[model samples]
Target: MKMSDKKEILNSDKAPEPVGLYPHARRVGNLLFLSGVGPRKRGSKEIPGVTLDHLGNIAAYDIEAQCHSVFENVRHVLEASGSSWDKLVDVTVFLTNMQDDFKTYNEVYARYFKDNQPCRTTVEVNALPTPIAIELKCIAVVDG
Candidate 1:
């Protein structure tokens, strides 16, 4: 579909506004591509206890919390795409500490995708935006 013809869903009142040069979610044809979601709370600093170096200075880096935040952002994006978690077809997880959080991550990931889990790829990266621990991007099929 043409850019002008494509439909954009913006829940400015309920969802976090786009922070960069992209929309939160957009639907084109039968596919929806959601931007990678960070751990930042809606219109607020990221929830505490989501940092890596906890004992030193409580740097906002908690692997479990980051996973949940990413999931929450994915949920919002899916809802905006006229679908829900069940419609997801693919997912890409980015993390800085894959070795340390792989098991815990899978545990939480399973809750969101309890049946027919979508195709997924997990990659351990050197770092992420703002040096966060995790990021998630989703793709879902949109129903007419």
Candidate 2:
């Protein structure tokens, strides 16, 4: 394989920079591994579509908005590595409240991955960065 065949690393100015010690995604061979993305906007802690209720009940956040944020992050990762959603193979979603959020999550997820829904698994977790509800991670095939 020519040196040009080497994997490319991607970062999008529109997406949040990796907060810890990692890049948004890394290319190895023909695969792109995207790290978990949250509702927080890139380079900031502002949570889009988040709202609160005055009835002593936390008004539910917009699952679709969160989903869109995740997808945008995914898109940046894929493009950074010269890939697309079509090349995705698998996804894993970490939910702080799967029971209440799965339906909404699926609704938005279906919109982006309508044709070929990649293999995926959703699991409930104990905590997340903030009051945000869900996060998603993905692995995709970078077609040459």
Candidate 3:
């Protein structure tokens, strides 16, 4: 395939830097694929609403705060990729404690997604790469 056919990596200065080598998002044709985004903000390691114990373990976390931050992060990525929240087609959410956090997460999710309802699948996971309790993987369409 030609080099032009390869995916274009996208990043957002308004969003948090990824913990790994990957860019915040990638564009393949008219579709924008976003990497997993957590609650951490740009230029900071502190997870929003997360309280750590003396041993650096997660002592407490606010799912609501994480949800809002993660959603805004997704928006930044989408916009940086030449897309928007209404352009999102699908989203996959990862939660470390589904049973305890789902309700609050869903409520916060409703506030942002009420108008632009995208296909979503939420699942419980043992852990994330970081101490964050929630993360979002999203895909959206870019206009030609």
Candidate 4:
């Protein structure tokens, strides 16, 4: 099949707009690849659980809140792409402060993927495009 015939762009109003030039997710054949998802609210720049100083440095943040928002955003993207949490195959997580936040993030993540846990890799990153505590990039397989 032609490339165009096997791919499609996915978007959801429930998720925030991409920080850069990209769709929320793209489906190639039956696999859906989601862009990095931050905790920013849909249709707004407000990031839950984030508190920044005057200079925009993170003063205090709640990793649990960020995790919930990020997963909710991922859920919206998955639903838009004709998939669901159970269909997720893999997840790549990025954290700004792994030492301080990994435990809380993991606790919240376990609540989301309690039964159908996807293969995951979590890594510490210097920063994210936004000032959020965490971000998630995921892949899922859609039903034919």
Best by TM-score: 3
Deviating ranges (above 4 Å) for candidate 1: 1-15, 51-60
Candidate 2 per-residue lDDT over residues 37-85, each given as its tens digit: 7777876766677775665333768777887887887787777777888
Compose the digit string of candidate 3's lDDT tens values, residues 24-83.
999988888999999898998888989999998999999999999899889888888899
Instruction: For residues 1-144, write the lDDT of model 1, one tens digit per residue.
Output: 665466655442334555678877667767887877766678665553464465543465567777777787778777866888888999999888888889988998888788759999999998776556777777888887
CA lDDT of 87 in candidate 3? 93
Q: lDDT of all the models against the reference?
A: 0.73, 0.79, 0.92, 0.91
Q: What is the lDDT of residue 9 in candidate 4?
A: 88
Error of 1 at 126 (Å): 1.3
Candidate 2 lDDT score at position 33: 85
Q: Candidate 1 vs candidate 3: which has greater TM-score?
A: 3
Candidate 4 lDDT, tens digit per residue, 1-144? 865369988998889999889999999988999999999999887899989899988888888888989999999999988999999999999999999999999888888899988999999999888888799999999888
Candidate 2 RMSD computed on C-alpha atoms after optimal superposition onto the true structure: 3.5
How far does residue 43 in candidate 3 sit from its true spot (Å)? 0.3
TM-score of each: 0.81, 0.83, 0.95, 0.94
Better of 1 and 4 by lDDT: 4
- Candidate 4's error at 100, in angstroms? 0.6
The per-prediction CA RMSD against the true structure, in angstroms, equals: 3.4, 3.5, 1.7, 1.6
